[model samples]
Target: MSINDIIAEKRKNVEEIETKIAQLNRKLSFSTLSEEKKKIMEEITKLEKQKRESEYELQKLQNERLNELAEQLRKRREQEKQEERLSTVLPPVEEFTLRVCFKCTEKTNCEAFLTKNRQKMLPCILSELLNH
Candidate 1:
């Protein structure tokens, strides 16, 4: 996915988390209740804490993504300089490479890595090659 796509996805996730936090708070606002209220309060607190942590992570990712874009622009300018100096250079897009997360396949059974989308299964490589 593009960087914009990633940022959009993160924003959506943040919004979902915020909605959950709000829902938890609304649930917590009930005054008249049995011991269940206390249990609900505890769960709300946990959810709020988790939301805070996730917000922090989202902020970190936003900053990192901005920095990565700046660095990429800088590298592109540097490459232009090298091309001017050397008279031979590759384009920025050609320089990029993707490395698969083998561990992600093993652990989560990542659907994206699979050759064929299955109702239930990891990539074929995980079962066939990795023998797991």
Candidate 2:
């Protein structure tokens, strides 16, 4: 359950305890129900303690959620700063060398062109015929 829901439930329980306590007080005033009054008072004490515990738990959950959000924000900011640094440090795309294949009309970067040319240096027979 959400923190607000937990808090509302606990408050409702506390209100119920208070209402019972009031009823018990009225009964005690009217008749000699000492034993019943004692039991009700003990129950009231337990309920009050539970209410305090609930309030403490609600506050703890709220603080934990806030801390989690703050941590995520910190991580996001660090990631953005790292990205900015990378963008500034890296070379521009236009500065890199490019090559085009005469036979296949394929375009590629210098590294890829070197690898492809190293694999097969000769132009295709069909390309030579088309050129002639």
Could you report the Cα RMSD, in angstroms, for every candidate shown? Answer: 22.7, 10.7
Query: Model 1: residues >4 Å from true position, as ranges?
Result: 79-132
lDDT digits (tens) for residues 1-132 of candidate 1:
876777677678778877876876787676567676788778777867877776787787788889998999999999999878664432232121112334444543555444433323334424443542
Q: How many clashes (backbone N, Cα, C below 3 Å) per candidate?
A: 0, 0
TM-score of 2: 0.48
Write down the lDDT of every candidate, Cα atoms only.
Answer: 0.62, 0.61
Worst 10 residues of 2 by lDDT: 91-100
Cα lDDT tens digits, model 2, 13-65, are: 66776677677667666766778768767776776777677667767766776
Error of 2 at 93 (Å): 6.3
For all predicted structures, in order, the TM-scores are: 0.49, 0.48
